[model samples]
Target: MRKLFSIIGLFVSCLLAAQEEEWRVIPSVREWLEEINNWPDSVYRQDNLHVFFDYEKDTGLIATTFEETDSLPSEPLFIVNKPVRVSGLNFAGDRKGPGTMPRRLTSIQFNGWLTISRMAQNRAGFVGCVFKDDMSMWDIQSRNVLQFVDCDFEKSLHLYGPQENMGFYIANTSIKEDLIITSGNTDAGIRILNSDLSQFFVNGKFTQFRMDSTNVRYGMRLSNVTISNSFQLQNTSLPALELIGTDFPELHTYIPFHNIENALALDLPIGWDRDQDLVKYKAESKEEIMDTQRFDNLIASYYTLLEVYKSRGELTSYNACYIEMRDKVTARSKLLYNQDPSFTNFFAYQINRFTRAFSDYGTRPEKAIIVFFQVVLAFSIFYFFFPSSWNTTNNRTMMRRLSYLGSYFTSKEGLSDLFEKEAKEDYKDYEEFHQFISSSEKRLPIYFQWLSKPLYRVSVSRFNLSRRLLASGDILKGEWDQLPKAKQVRTSILIGLYLVIYLIYVLIIRCLNAITLSLNAFSTLGFGEIPTRGLARYVTIIQGFVGWFLLSIFLVSLIGQILN
Candidate 1:
């Protein structure tokens, strides 16, 4: 008998472990009251209520209520003790009362969290139901109860009633703030107002509610959002408003409400139809990935030229070098032009990407040297036959002209004048403009080719003659300058001297441009191929150096014979 009792106890324990709390549906208001009065102090979950009304049937404070109905239970109440999720909540029934009669309960409150997961789906095809009754301290102070009824409360309404109520209140009572209404739709929505006379702090997706000036109350305000398709109403006072993404001001848009002290990043359209205009701009400038390789070499050639100028210690040349380098960096920045919202985003993104790699594997001086040398050699070989293709004068002019055009649309005063002119020609017709930018990008090699020709002649002469000059006793600092007698006799050789220096400068520029452009196009690989292109471009850049060495050696030999 003792063994049998033990087995039975084990079975009972197992049954309790697997048991789940059940929901109770009360169809009548009297039944709801009976359940609440007899309910335990512990938590209970209620469910399956077709309608709930807030009428003064007798009790001063009733948690749930509904309008009068026939065939109701004599004295019915159902108490639930478990977490419950009601599939539907409908309050379509009507009640008779004075004009000031509260169609819904005036003060409904919850001690625990009442999370409405999907408000949009919950509020389909229902109208004229009092969303909430609030005489709670929070409700009276919020000054936004009327907003709940006037606006589309069916969308997302959190009515604050009594502070003591627990069923609907789902926030930390310890928190000195208002109750929070969190709606979990594609548009996360919220409506929060703490105490009476306090301003309503509304946020989340306004597009879900579609609340405009005609419906929204003066006390209720809205702010932060991930996205919006609604237009901003004029004469609205929302201090905390923000519009994210690229500027498309002409479309319907609304601003978020921000407090006076916390400044927000407001995006204003700098150019007309900014998003579409940017697309066209980006498309026009988009060079084929393969074409970028050639452009990279061209930039490398200019960089090589800059190095020669730097070696010569010319301040003007250095300034020109700085400007060209800036342009190269800026051009690379354009390739990844999506780092931020404003003008510098692309440039910043490109720079940051290169800098990250530059920090890695490129920290050592020897590694830097090897990387740069490789870029020069690779770029030189690519443009060796077309040296003049590295010229940058036209590219610089084109960018400058575009800047001027940007500036023309900057001011409202000039906007009218510019629009009048722009209107004469269809602004929408971008085919010519597109072609112009494309042709310029495509002709990048031609510029370097022109710049490289004179460089080739100089490189050849430096390899043959300059080396001999440096070696001979006759050659000294004076050789750095052209001889007066040579002016009469060796005009050809003087021209050679000019070519050598010019070639060195051009080669330096080309090296810089090539590596920079490559980095922009290939990102992480840009630094890796630095040595590859550097070494190739440097072959041509260094060819002139080799000529200098040979010329110096031959001159030293000739001078020794004369001295002996």
Candidate 2:
């Protein structure tokens, strides 16, 4: 008898443990109320209908609210001590009879497979809940706050047509699939904090919207969203953001470049019919008429973003937005050209394209310089191959002309023939003195030989023959011809060496002259006479015109940067 009693006690204990592991389903509102009412006063508070579940017991409760028949007890709080799965919990605040007090559900821990439908005229808050299936809330209308905290939704969460709420707050939540909110209007604001979401879409009108420390793995789209107050985003990672017909009074974002994977789509057509097959219709068709308002809105949006980034000192984002804006403008101009087919429209489109390629719409001045050098180098190579296209005047003549121009501008003496003659005489005397010092070594006294030796060395170093030979082809050829014939055969090897060096020197000089000519044409400096003839002269004129245009743009950009 003692052994049987012990066995019975053990069996009872094991059955209780099995029951604790399974969910206790409250079949109706009557049963749910009775179970909570019988709870000890220490665990249940009457004023707020707050019930604290026993944590030590590890009870898993399942509650059901039938929208068609049973109604939830008024203003009930359901707090779970352990993981609980609540199914078919429906709140129909709108369906309540007149003078019926609205139900307020607070501190509800929905552990699994929750679906809320027709929730209205009441407040609801959920915390630390893990939803196992797709959860959706439709037609939610609450005067008090609707809040979700520390929740994880394993599947998609959708909220539809939530209207006139005090505020909607979601924090520290994770959604595995898309979290979509559509047509939501709020009085206070909507705040999402420290949430990890997949695809997120919000199309609503709100007093304000704030998101912080949230990461969206997929793309986010805000279509037709209007915010009367500020929209703030801080420390949010948005891989792809699309803004279509979205308007806000102010945008405050502290997102880094890496957080934004794609460029913001500010230029998306606003007024076009999104439901139609736009790709099938030709742009020139009447149905595809450009909306001027849409274009202006896009420009205004870009300008606003640019100002915000500039104020925040985000130069990379500012430059990116500026480039995108310019491209949009160019696209608009192209559309106008397609519609009108007029010279003005065509020219505008072409010029925008040219500027975009040449300097990235003037945001990068270095791009302009790079393109300028590329043009100069290309022309230089062309001129190098076709020597006859350009004139190779005497190097001495070019130098003399340059010297004359410099003297004309800087000389204390006026630009007169007497001034020129004095300059020539001075030059001639200096040349003669240099020759005497360099060649005539016996003219110096023994006492002054030290000074003479230094001066001679200086003169020889200053007037190196190799440099003169490189500077002028005529000088090199003359020196070679001046060699004595009988001695030339004796020094035939030396002659061959000189010829080889001269050929190399000529090639280098020719290349440098080609580059110089290209530079002169590109700068349009006209420091001396034009060195091209025939078609090349026309090409140089074209190059000069292009140079003037690009240089003007570069100067404007530089000045703007400095002023800013």
Candidate 3:
């Protein structure tokens, strides 16, 4: 009789277990309340929600709402002690998603402000669920977690009164308003992924808010984010607003809050559009800018309003406040720049206008180098037309009469060779020098080619004697001083003296000696070099005077470029 009873008990237990695992249909809100209120401790797991089988059918699992007239206490709408799962949030009504089967949309609506108050190890989770109104958490107990995936909150979510060590994971969701936390959260964490929010705030605390691929309209205004142990807002376009003790500490866009005191490393367009006429530069976007004190105070309030409107999901009001604040700040910045006579502000604007393209304040060192070369080229032109004064009878009236066209193919070395003793239109020596390399490279080994590089450079550096001949021809053509015999005899004597000093100087001044001699002559830095007797002394004096003005401007511009 005992063995028969034992066998019967075992069969009944197995049947009960099968029934527990079966999906039961959820009835009215009042019925769900009665069902979970007296759940067994073994049936409900801490930090986990097993709601898949808790609901009867997969097709339509809905949460019923209470009427506004029903004056219930501040208790949560559902005091669920059973483990819940965020496994069935489906918006398409046809549950077709990863880790979810074919089920209808799980829609939950509240009369007004809905509250989810959790305590002990009991947690709440919603998946593929949509909340039709504002959602708030009254008091989240320690070690309790609230999570949502593929959920939509039609309004704001308040998480103020949660206990320490509480956590939440929200992903693939949209918070139409703010995810605000007024208080509570000691060593707690909240992770949101691929979600969108208008604003996020934590009341100047250090609860880490980690998110990736999330977009926040107005951004986060927390006091200390980096103070948290593992803070991350990776690949999100939420600009940091709290200047003190806050940072993204991961992937972020926009300059940091601490970097705002410096001029926005941004170049403004002259107007909204590019134009050929300079009139656009004179156009002001705003008519008036307030005083510094008043503007500062006004912006603080404006910033607040901007955030507040953004948190409310008021798009029109958010945009209006944002644009107004932007315009005011821009106008005030211009006012500050114009009011100061210190070249600091003026040149910062102007130089960046060229180097940075007056759009993005991205630095272009190449443009600065190009401008430097252009200025140097202008000075090179001035040197070309400068008078060979002392050579003429009336030194003051002496004009550099060398043909501009001829200067393109000339050097003083070849001119000296032609006018003195070696007077010829063709240079056989230079031709031999060129032909030697062209023929020699063919027969040489690869190793010899490497050795011949220095020789090749030396060969190429020598001016073309053929062009030099043409240039010298132009230099000597115009003259009544054609007593060729006597003049040639006198020139030979002068030529001998000139070559000795010229060759010596050329040898001493290696091509790169410009760093020493040219720079010395180009600045008022009195580290002087003695030039051989010629037009050089006069050139030096003139160069030094002109370079002082040019160099000063360049130095100012260079500083601006580096700083900006």
TM-score of each: 0.24, 0.55, 0.45
- 2 or 3, greater by TM-score: 2
Model 1, 382-474: lDDT tens digits are 654333333452345446545534544343323234333534344333445445545666566777656655655564454435435433422
- Those runs of model 3 whose alpha carbons end farther than 4 Å from true positions after fitting are 1-30, 33-111, 118-123, 142-144, 223-226, 239-334, 337-370, 387-564
After TM-score superposition, the amount by which residue 105's alpha carbon in candidate 1 deviates from its true location, in angstroms, is: 2.8
Which of candidates 1 and 3 is the stronger one according to lDDT?
A: 3
Q: Could you give candidate 2's per-residue lDDT for residues 370-483 as a string of tens digits?
A: 988998999888777554334443455456645653443344333343233535655565578767765665766765766766765675555444335434432122233345
lDDT of each: 0.35, 0.60, 0.47
After the best TM-score superposition of candidate 3, give how far the Cα of residue 560 lies from its true spot, in angstroms.
Answer: 13
Deviation (Å) of 298 in candidate 2:
5.0
Displacement of the residue 499 alpha carbon in candidate 1, Å: 76
Query: Which has the better TM-score: candidate 1, or candidate 3?
Result: 3
lDDT of 2 at 450: 68
Please give the distance, in angstroms, between residue 306's alpha carbon in candidate 1 and its true position after superposition. 40
Candidate 3: lDDT of 182? Answer: 47
